[model samples]
Target: DFPPLLISLGDLRRGFVFHEVKQVLITDEDIFKRYRERRQRWVGEEEKKIERWTELRGGDYVVHIDHGIGKFSGIKTLKLQGRKCDYFQVNYKGTDRLYIPLDQLDRLHKYMGDSDHPPPIYSLEGGQWRLTKRRVRKAARDLASSLLRLYSIRKVIPGYHFSLDTDWQLEFEASFPYQETPDQLRATHEVKQDMENPSPMDRLVCGDAGYGKTEVAMRAAFKVVMDNKQVAMLVPTTILAEQHHRTFRERIAAYPIRIEMLSRFQGLKEQKDIVTSLKNGGVDIVIGTHRLIQKDIEFKDLGLVIIDEEQRFGVIQKKKLRELRSSVDVLTLSATPIPRSLYMSLMGVRSMSMIVTPPKERLNVETQVAEYNEE
Candidate 1:
């Protein structure tokens, strides 16, 4: 037996304890489990909200996985078999319309093609869509085979094996202001491991904008520079090249590494001097646009090539990159990767690391559409 505890009306009024408690719960395991399940469901719904089709409006082009490209006319509710059901209305060429039930919305995707010229809508008759898909599949297969052959050749050729990180590298990374996310750390580790191996590194780092993809590339560049090898950062446009040049300079300011930018913005004499410096190993890292691939530009010992927005490069520029792929380490960074890159990564032809975790306090981008007005 123990002394009796007094219960006060003040406690009950303040919600500290119940006035007349019949039963007391000992554990909250069930409540916690339910809370977790609800949280997961909320996350799933949020992801679905960001799907491309959610923003589809009337008159927008859409592609049906089985029916090819068509124009979205909007949703409609119509009576079918004595019952009313909601269906997606899609209009094809020459008054051809398709009604897809709401249950099959997963088969539709917003059309992503050239904005200036629309793709030809496939006819629903005569199996033309099937034939077109078959031809595309064959082309894709051939492309994959060629990519595999190229990757195999790259594996056989030995590349510059960079040593592990040094004291300076640690210090440089520690100077970063923000904490590194888990995905960023993992991607950095994988890149360094690839550099340490003798095989050439052809890894794709896919992440959204402002997700520290540049930080990963900078770390790799620092490692390569530590081993007395140069790094060439190729961008798609002059503006991008300039932006990267600024970023690299700011990040490596305390170090003795020399970074130069090559674009049409530089004077003729300055361009010649930069090119000379590259040939004589005066420059450690170079960030440039397609101008870097011109006949005159040369590097003393380029061990790493970082291509930003690789999909934006044209066929000719990419062809030149393919030639370099056999010898030097290549790292491609893209926020919106093209289908070829995705397929290559999936097929194991090239290594890939994804930085999916956004930074703390980072908010989702908001998009708004309005009619263009001169004012």
Candidate 2:
């Protein structure tokens, strides 16, 4: 038998040792940094999928797998083992409070029980929450039937696996006049990640009117278009369609995407021509009113559908959209947050991203007061 030996052959301190042969190769800092960053992003995404739970605001109803329903009372810091740690505070029925450590958030979920209204707050005594959970779970089971059809379809149906964002996406997002809020950034990332995945995305982005919901949707739209896929944006009113068309055109000016609008403003012939272009794959993005859901409209390769103010759409239009929900990646935006009714309707069905934080900067409105004492 031969004895093992070690030898160093290169500048790098790290080496591979064999009986009499040893070699070391230095890693390039730039390449290694890029790879490390990429790996970090991938790991982050995977961690995100483990327990996808939304942030709970104070007073919002939530479910504790063991304790049933409660209202989030915010985080409180307490000294334990001579160290200060934050604990999640939840207020239950009848002056009962449950304090859960931050590490156990997975046990909690945003409560979505009973249609139109949540069950009355469960008291801590007499095991009332157990009964409430059973009743609510039953109601959820009944409502969940309508939602699972879409959920099942989404699981099997394969959507276009879009490529990652290009440099153009970064540039377009940078050109925005205002800074992107944290909620907006997360929502945009979720949208882009969904587009890159094989399964269809049916995410509902809920936010206030002045928040940056439009910006988030636009960023996703830009990503979809960058992948050479067409995008269709449905607005409730013609004025909004025009506004969005102009906004998209301006932000994506650097890209070669062709933007068009279809509303009452366009003549009947023009509408037909735009529809033709869409089917022939000439247009990259189209902004339109509710008429976009009409039977005559079609797309060549629509990868994404952005519906603004979804609550404004009528039952007929919603029915029309129901069919498309499974095939295409849909992003719905609204000024007001998703109501309990809508949430319950889609519960256990689709992913929802909310943007409750307001924008950082805005102009103030002047006000005047008059005294009518003499009148």
Best model per lDDT: 1
Cα deviation of 338 in candidate 2 (Å)? 5.5
Per-prediction TM-score: 0.66, 0.57
**Per-residue lDDT value at 16 in model 1:** 30
What lDDT would each prediction earn against the true structure?
0.85, 0.77
* lDDT score at residue 288, model 1, on the 0-100 scale: 95
Best by TM-score: 1
Candidate 1 residue-wise lDDT at 135 = 100
lDDT string for model 2 (1-375, tens) is 424533323224222434454533344533355345423433332121215324667788877766767888998988866778878888988789888877777657776656677667666678876677579769768546745787688788788898877888788888898887899889898888888899998888887777788899888888888888889999889989988889888878877889999986789899989999999999999999877888888898999999888778776776677677878999988766346435643674567788888887755445689887886
Candidate 1 — which residues are off by over 4 angstroms? 1-112, 120-142, 363-375
Residue 354 lDDT (model 2): 80
User: Candidate 1, after superposition: displacement of residue 265 in Å?
Assistant: 3.0
Where does candidate 2 clash, by residue pair?
A: none
Clashing pairs in 1: none
| C-alpha positional error of residue 189 in candidate 2 after TM-score superposition, expressed in Å | 1.2
In candidate 1, what are the lDDT values of residues 316-358, reduced to their tens digit? 8987887778889999999988777877788887899999999
